[model samples]
Target: MISHRAPDSLSTWRAAILIAVIALLVSCGKPPPKEISTLDKIRTTGVITLGIRETSVPFSYLDDAQQQAGYAWEIANRVATAVKRDLKLDTLAIHTFVVTPQTRIPLVANQTVDLECSSTTHDRERERQVGFSSSFYLTGPRMLVRRDSPVRDWSDLRGKRAVVSSGTTAELALRKLDRERGLDIEIMLAKDIGENFMTVETGRAAASVQDDVILYSNIARARDPSAWQVVGAPLMREAYACMLRKGDVPFKRLVDATIAEMARSGELMQLYTKYFASSLAVKGGVRIDQPLSDDMRELLRQPNDRID
Candidate 1:
């Protein structure tokens, strides 16, 4: 995580230090809850705040005009529709904010965004600070490596340097594996997905580790797509879902119910086809059709926020 501070406010050094220490202790990495509910605030203001990712391809990403597009963005549109109807409003304006990997969780916790419609996974650790809607997609950890590299599987990358975005499932899994297996792999952290790929592509790291789908998206955008190959079995399972603030049961119920309705009505399949069935022509254009794996199909049968 990046931390910034005032260059030098040393005129009253002792007072400044005391205030900074107090502020840090009070915040404690989590934001305080707001009295007004997310839905209530939205209805009162006639606008829904959505947090998006400009680099999360086939999920939440920005197009040439900076308008949000992709699978997650489309799903968010449906949720917005549901919210408008629920609030008895003909139309509600959407206030979109671009967020990086490090900031999305805090943004949701701080109530800066009503819903984060990006490719955030529903993991138990993340559940502690924020709430999640029903699982929308499923993926697993994988690696992207140079085509000519000898690494082909977990065993092959025994002592290699791997890069993952900070605060991601990939990083968490890698750290755990490194400790448990005594692999002694050098783990490097990147600020976001884009840099995660760069760390590998530039040969500074041996592999770019992340969710399989995300790595595939990066490969499609790579300068030399043919130069990199996605290898190795999945390290761990991941359930992708939208993120919101915790303790908002009413808002969560509405979001989950809306997702369930979409799934039951086949509207979800339409969206799945729209983004994954055909060749995705986004900034990082690729012909990757990641259909519902058997596990994913079963997840649709029963949707919940629980990671397990």
Candidate 2:
């Protein structure tokens, strides 16, 4: 039997205050939810984004069918597969975003894109904004000129008009050389590799300065391959590596391990042969026709992320 009493108002108010204080203590004792990381976000969403170049040829490009097809494109897919396996996802979706030289860094830095494995050169300056995976390929700036042109080397470009893709290491190197040697070269900037090549093809510029491999690829796809020539030795060797967001230790480790595994297992060499040796399936079966260089072979033998 319960007793009903309206005479204990003071005691009832004290009991209510005590209950409120206990509730507050319990709420304060529990920990907050953990903040999500890049991998965590990817695991939750089951999607990975890849940044690709549309006209970088064997590195990353759109094929005749408009599908992303290239050596780096294949490597990016492999990394995506690793992510799915690491996250234990039943199915992981791949989303591609086209990135130019100008936009790739910002996209990765701001987390708009997960990673980029194209014809990007990894250098100390870029390391300030983003991280890089193991070096996958190596090449340097060279000149692509008409077959009959008198320009045989960088020295020959003095007082001539030259075209280079905007925001590329080639542009930076060319400008530095111009100032140092007083070449007085009229520099022309193009938005993409296609435009750079076209500028030279249309006689608007005497030469197109770019990576040696890219010049070879352009000639391979040309109507008359013999009409052009890649001249001069490499100006300065540059390493090509996959780019990711800065300070992402786990993701960087995963990417570095993936690249090292490919190098150790000779899969990277096979990929090299597939794109550089054999005829490609793009643009009606074009071939880059470039032999593997000693530097590239060394890079495969020992995968590293050293940038100079």
TM-score quality measure for candidate 2: 0.83
In model 1, what is the error at residue 18, expressed in angstroms? 3.9
**What is the alpha-carbon lDDT for the whole of candidate 1?**
0.82
RMSD of every candidate to native, in Å, equals 5.6, 14.0
Instruction: Compute each candidate's TM-score over C-alphas.
Output: 0.86, 0.83
- Model 1 pairs whose backbones collide: none
Which candidate's TM-score is highest?
1
lDDT of each: 0.82, 0.89
Off by over 4 Å in 2: 1-36
Cα lDDT tens digits for candidate 1, 268-293: 77777777667665653565555467
Q: Could you tell me which 10 consecutive residues in candidate 2 have the lowest summed lDDT?
A: 30-39
- Model number with the top lDDT: 2
| Alpha carbon lDDT at 33, candidate 1 | 48
**lDDT, model 2, position 242:** 94
